[model samples]
Target chain A: MIRTAISAMLLASAAPALAEIHSVAPGEGAQERLQEALILAEPGDEIVLAAGRYELTDGLSLDVDGVTVRGAGMDGTVLDFTTQAGAGEGLLVTSDNVTLRDFAMENPKGDGIKSKGADNIVYYRIRVTWTRGPHPENGAYAIYPVESTGVLVDGVKVTGASDAGIYVGQSDRITVRNSIAEANVAGIEIENSRNALVEHNIATRNTGGILVFDLPDLPVMGGGNVIVANNLVVANDTANFAPPGNIVAGVRRGTGIMVMANEDVLIENNILSGNPTAPVMVIAYVQPYDDERYNPLPRGVVVGQNTFDGGGYDPQLEGGEMLKAAFGGELPPVMWDGLGSLYVTGDAPGWSLNLTEQGKGLGAAQPAPLAAPAPEAEFDRTGIGAPAELEARLSR
Target chain B: MKFGTASLLAASLLLAGTVIARATPPPEQYVNDAAIMDGGLPRLLSDYGFFADAPAQEPVPEVHPYRLNTPLYSDGADKFRFIYRPAGAQISASGEGLLDIPVGSALIKTFAFGEGKDRRLIETRVLLHRADGWLALPYLWNEEQTDARLAVAGARIDLTTPRGEAISYRVPNKNQCKECHGLDREVVPIGPKARNLSGDWLEQMVAAGHIDRMPQGADRLPLWEHRGKSSVEDAARAYLDVNCAHCHRPGATASNSGLDLRWEQDDARALGIMKRPTAAGRGAGNLLFDVVPGDPDASILLHRMIVNEPGVAMPELGKATVDEEGVEAVRKWIAGMEPR
Candidate 1:
């Protein structure tokens, strides 16, 4: 019995001692060193990338669980993929409980820093830039996390993507806070996901700022239970540079905080300015779909108190001049398609399309002032956002 | 039971004869079975002793050569495949699924380019079936054609394809191998399913006592050389099964897209018939649906295969040039579909 107790104590002390640090420096053979460090790392190990420029030709990946990849700073450590010849992304993380922080990737041929099926992942203080401004040939997304649960993205900056700057798709329990998404097609988009909290972010100079959508024919469906609050969405008047046939390519040039085909979404306490399109728009899915499991209507969407300034002055809608003249120069702060359920907490001025059903053409709409009823009760705040334990990693 | 005993006796006799012939054997002449089961990574490809002559592509005893019915296109480079089985161990097989390779076994494949005299081996990849799981590793060949060293980060080489296009060839890194061989977060072998193997190979293995029995669904995929005799649908389905099904099916990396191109998938909608893309982004390329019936020109699935762009290309790795033959087969199948 005494021997058993001593062995158990030894086992307990061995774990922390086994954790190691693998430091990689940038120079001639940084590609081999950094990639070897990523592949050979063990669980609970840390891989540190020193401050320099890494000229990489191929993509890198990590599949070790509970590993942390850190850099000196987001600006100090740059992974330049200007001459990238292969692979689908700049860096791919396929392991669970991984933390990636303080690194920047420039001019990747595809999406930048994609994490698929990597649960409980944290992406902190990272930057992904296209170098060239908005162009149709830029990579799809800057920071993409898909098909995973418990994702936390904090203090990241992304720019000049043809698609969404920060896109989280087909996942649950996501929190995107204190980030900046600029000069992309759609800034900060949450698609086909659930229980998301997008707060305290700055979204500017894109085609659409802050979109929450539920697309059809995905593995996970019925995206809802989202809260978009305390964000600064302004001046998203850049022309849509997304390649044609993408869903975001159909987005208007100056949209702010748009929610499409979702359920039980709450938009509150945001500052909207310099948006020519409607400051807050809610609508049904416009395209025809064949999936029986899909519901293309926006239901239980509530708009709470928000500040709107200098918006809707030059709306980007069909018959914009006629609508402006009808509304006595400049439309209202909110726009609805009149095919779904919407609630307003106060007297927020808005207009509606007044369409009868889904998949109806815009020509069938009868324009009228919005007459939304007040919300019935308090919105449920349970089981939202990433798990609180993810914050502890940032502190470490 | 008596027949099984007789076959086992004969197998042991054959092994004993081969061992007696190599009395003063050079150390590298035999396979290193311990290296296959060990936990540490071997630094060089020759450390495993898979090849008796590292330059001539010769195999040692108990190493078997195999071929697939329809192979994946890797810029038209020739592939040499081998499987190494330890003494007294057997490979188990089910109907049409992947072969159940036992622990301490390894699969080696070498990719080479050019004709008889100018032939150069670029890289050799191995899949070691260890105790924990299958581990994939890549080794790069040297300029002298002597041996290959382990390259965890992979390398790029400039070469000309068979189609006369000058391009850069990329050898996949250690983790990049998992991008194609991963299922449910575990590394696995993508090729060597029973359906893709020939019936004659299975019979020969069974006779030699290397495998338990003939697989039920053996020799189902159409051969690439004899594709002219097969139907367009058969060839097209075989191409999709070998090239696209690794990541497109459920529980794989691209599972979020909701498209399943596996051979056994029967549902029309699951096979991307008029299915809209969820997150194709710029890869959609002005196309609406993934597959438009009777219109190959409008199908996003065909467009992605034809394009050479990085983000838009299908089978994101291992192919730098378009397969014109594969594209024609898929186009014919799609053109024959009935539009609804």
Candidate 2:
């Protein structure tokens, strides 16, 4: 008995210390208390918010690494910024290994949740929404992670952003899955990023479903190796409400997926339907640009096995002018801008369109005429195999 | 009697030497104290005494006191009085052409409204130079207006402007202040550039021993009222430089857009002339380019400037109302542009 007691005591002593949990309740100065908790938290500390509405003026920022901020539930705990007077983001994380979960941010003056130059950030079960619906005055982004690495956003629902609902820019090794994006300009945008995996997300009633784009003159470039698969992208016929001069403004109303100026992107196994414009579009980054460092061609794209239902009727005449001219009013399920360099020495082309097991209606438009000619034989199924293999090769 | 006079003279000289030595001590090491009082306030401000007298008087000349070339336009609600206080003898200019203020310096900007008997002080934002980085501290004035208290989380004050406009002035938190003030992901001063300070202020700073020498060929940024006085291009560029360049400059927060509006930037694309918007959503206002050469109405820059919407507005923060005069100036400049 004595030996057993000693062993139990030793084991108890050997275990790590219990992490500190700071709880905040709604009160006159609840925001202040929460802010104090964030500032006072150490590594491995958890700051929990009770189930109530907390009205905040200034946004909250966490710079303590290895801290966890949790709420009672996404629908129970609410952080409302309706009367926000500051310009800072709702929840700005500038620390590594920070996990934010089970919270909802409402009506921020700026971005909802933003992480800058941080790494190993995980956001789970978070909802960011504008209460007044979509307008030009809405915040720019719902969940914006910029210049970060190893970011994982899962089970988040975002809506009513003037810009992209879930935007990952200038980041690397990002995974956004099991999210719902609705009523935003671009539903889920992976811009100027590398090695992103977007899968199993439900994108509906947005301007465009998913976008993989590389903008010029950013700190990071050469965005590639993006896999967008097994998602339900449907009825994204929302009129592009994005303000002018943004790259998303060029997106057609009903585009399911768009790949612009990116390389080695694999699109597979998604259910795309009810999009009036082309379901999938591959185009060059031919906007009037001055940065010479950016590559403007989409190369090595493999599209396969996506179930398409009811699309390409009543296309956006103005937004999809090129596509409309090429394939008439009834657009195709997949479209490509056939403008890129040719392979000089090798038997293969610089950019190859590998389409297999896709449900019909695919077309390509030449760069010069901007009109529909006969389908080019070179772009017609260059014998690329399964999308999984292509994805594996590209990722490597 | 002669011996007594000699001893008295020696004592006076000793006292003078003590005073001089105390005035010119090395910069104090920084400590990250959450409570601003822990750093020993009232004493820190009084000992350093960047101002010549208490309760807002003249500035101490030896502190290398200076002012901005053009002030950033806050909401029409409050007016600001800005002063720069370098820690040591002089400010060393960095190779990147920005003022490398030594640690322990401070940028003090006092926000107030009205003048004379109706004047009411709002708050003072102090950008303290620390070893790790610049720390922003906001001190809210008491009702009596005799003193201020350090408010870290920030405060909101409702007041009427001199123009009879009722406004709610939001004192930004420390992170909010760093939002635009951060450069290359590091907290730095927004103003005090060679191009912005190329006017008489540079000469005055040089004369007061604030800087060793003035940078050659530095372009001067004119005040906003100089719209009608100077060339339209100069006035427009100055307005953008003061209001937008802090975030729009290269390596700054808005550099992701590929637009650099620093006064020294000569590239047409960097200046956003005929440049397409990168990530602008509805901020583009259906315009084709940021600037459409000869068409101001068609320029997204002007559209963002004129709008008060959250996503479409330019400068994004610090202003609740539009600066009609600034918008008109830029409009005239763009209207007068020759199409490329």
**Is model 2 an incorrect, acceptable, medium or high docking prediction?**
acceptable
Model 1, global lDDT:
0.87
DockQ per model, Cα: 0.59, 0.33
Q: Candidate 2 at residue A321, lDDT?
A: 63
Best by TM-score: 1
* Best model per DockQ: 1
TM-score of chain B of 2: 0.78
Query: Model 2 over residues A1-396: C-alpha lDDT tens digits?
Result: 653554465467742134567898877997778877886576667898999899987678777777788898789889998977655468888778778888899999778998877787888889999987778778778999888877888889999988899999988888888999999988999999988889999999998999999877666889877888899999998998776557787788898988988877777789998887767777777554567788877766666568877546766744456545654545657666564321111111112233221222134322232222322223332222222322221111
* Per-model TM values vs. the true structure: 0.93, 0.79
Worst 10 residues of 2 chain A by lDDT: A341-350
Deviation from native of the Cα of residue A105 in model 2, angstroms: 1.5
Least lDDT summed over 10 consecutive residues: which range in candidate 2 chain B? B29-38
lDDT of 2 at A95: 74
Interface RMSD of 1: 1.2
Shift of residue A383 alpha carbon in model 2, Å: 26
